[model samples]
Target: MRPDPHFLRGGQGGFGLVAAMFVIIVVAGAVAAMARMSETQNATSRMAIQQARAYQAARAGIEWGIHRALAGESCSDTFTLEGFAVAVQCDTGAAVSLPEEGRSPRFVSLRASAQYASPGSPDHVYRQLSAVVEKDD
Candidate 1:
């Protein structure tokens, strides 16, 4: 006996239903991936800003140390700024590094470092910077 035409028509629609479901799943996955990418980009930008701030803070420490060194400050001294502590060290002769001859006329070198409490962590972040300054001589 031949099968009913209506039963055969019902079977034909099954392929189209499965294909539609697959397309919907793929679109949802694509959207989820884009959201994750956006979050990562935002995190990168925040890290860059933090690094720039750290660099600036380190520079400030260097400048302060150089000023004190030019005035004949001793080594192992500390300078404080915005809850950060800067340690200064000075040396002379071969022990100390001076600017290249005829470069900037600076005879003394100063090294400064700053330590800050890490954000949302038990650790800390420290940065060091150096500069060469000219003596009154």
Candidate 2:
């Protein structure tokens, strides 16, 4: 009539299996979280690149418009550059009267906007640029 020590040890058998399963679940969760973070980081990087490209396209459009305005050419058009669509608008303002030097100058306003995106995609980027140029009249 003795209480067997082996009986208590038998209950400990399932403990190892439970601990192993818990470790496996924790590792899996960590791996999944890391994967998600990497994806997000990649997406952010891509968006940043797209934004830079759009900005460059808009800046180019603004320069083009300014050049055209200074050359006395009308500026109003849309074009594509580096995978982005750029729109430009430019106009010459009233001439400045300088009586002392007997010279007149005109101010040309130029604006450009660029956009890049795929249809129905959330990763869209846009940029705008404005400039003013002075021309002798």
Candidate 3:
């Protein structure tokens, strides 16, 4: 039996086409995965920045409260730091209650509540911090 000229020349032309398609598919998938990972990393960095801003805002609120308590001034307003805002309460009402053993007579409790926008959203993110400021006597 004599072989056909086309088959004798090469029967693997379609195989090469199929292999090329497979390689293209794999490369496309890898590119997509890398894009997703890059987006995730950028989002994480943004969140870290927002968290740092909120913490600084909270610290500012604490300082403001301490100053108000020491000077006998009112400390019941929202204070802004950078782009973050905080609510301060520096009175005897929500004072930091100490355990019976380690109570100090010259201590004042400072409470601060901070609210800022989420890194990728318009919704707010809230944080609370409390400290006991000892008198400078």
Candidate 4:
């Protein structure tokens, strides 16, 4: 309702509005950046947990192979655990005779691998392990 003294004279006006707009833009940008950073951190944490789980899965596979070999069975399997794909392969070596000790010893070798996702994926996790055990007759 007041007379437009600055508008008629074409004087500078709306400085407060301009300042408010700048502040809003800056605040919006800051909020977006924080959100992006938080999302990245969350993703990293999930990947780390997946990595550890994959390792455990692979280790379990190795142990399973050793157990089967000790029980006089061939070991080879593919399975899934906790969203991870696990594979184990085993090889049994020829028996070695020990005449001096009156005993024959056989060795079993195992290899295991665990994968959380397809290869080359951003969140993929993988783990591999190898073990050798003595199979006493």
Count clashes in each candidate, considering only residues at least 3 apart in sequence or on different chains.
0, 0, 0, 0
lDDT of 2 by residue, 18-120 (tens): 9999999999999999999999999999989888888889999998898788777888899988778899998788999999999999998889999888646
C-alpha lDDT score of every prediction, in listed order: 0.69, 0.89, 0.76, 0.92
lDDT of 1 at 1: 100
Which candidate wins on lDDT?
A: 4
When 1 and 3 are scored with TM-score, the better candidate is 3
What would the TM-scores of all predictions be? 0.63, 0.90, 0.76, 0.85
Model 4 lDDT tens row, 14-73: 778999999999999999999999999999999999988999999999999998989987
* Candidate 3 total steric clashes: 0
**Which scores greater on lDDT, model 2 or model 3?**
2
What TM-score would candidate 3 get against the native? 0.76
For residues 1-137, what per-residue lDDT tens digits would candidate 1 score against the true structure? Answer: 99998887885867988999999999999999999999888877876665566667778767766666667765447766776666777654333344665343336777777776755753356777877766653
Clashing pairs in 4: none
Model 2: per-residue Cα lDDT at residue 32: 100
Q: Candidate 3's residue-wise lDDT over 14-130, tens digit each? A: 898899999999999999999999999998887777777777788889888888877767766786776687899765543444667555345677789888865466445667889
**TM-score preference between candidates 2 and 3, better one:** 2
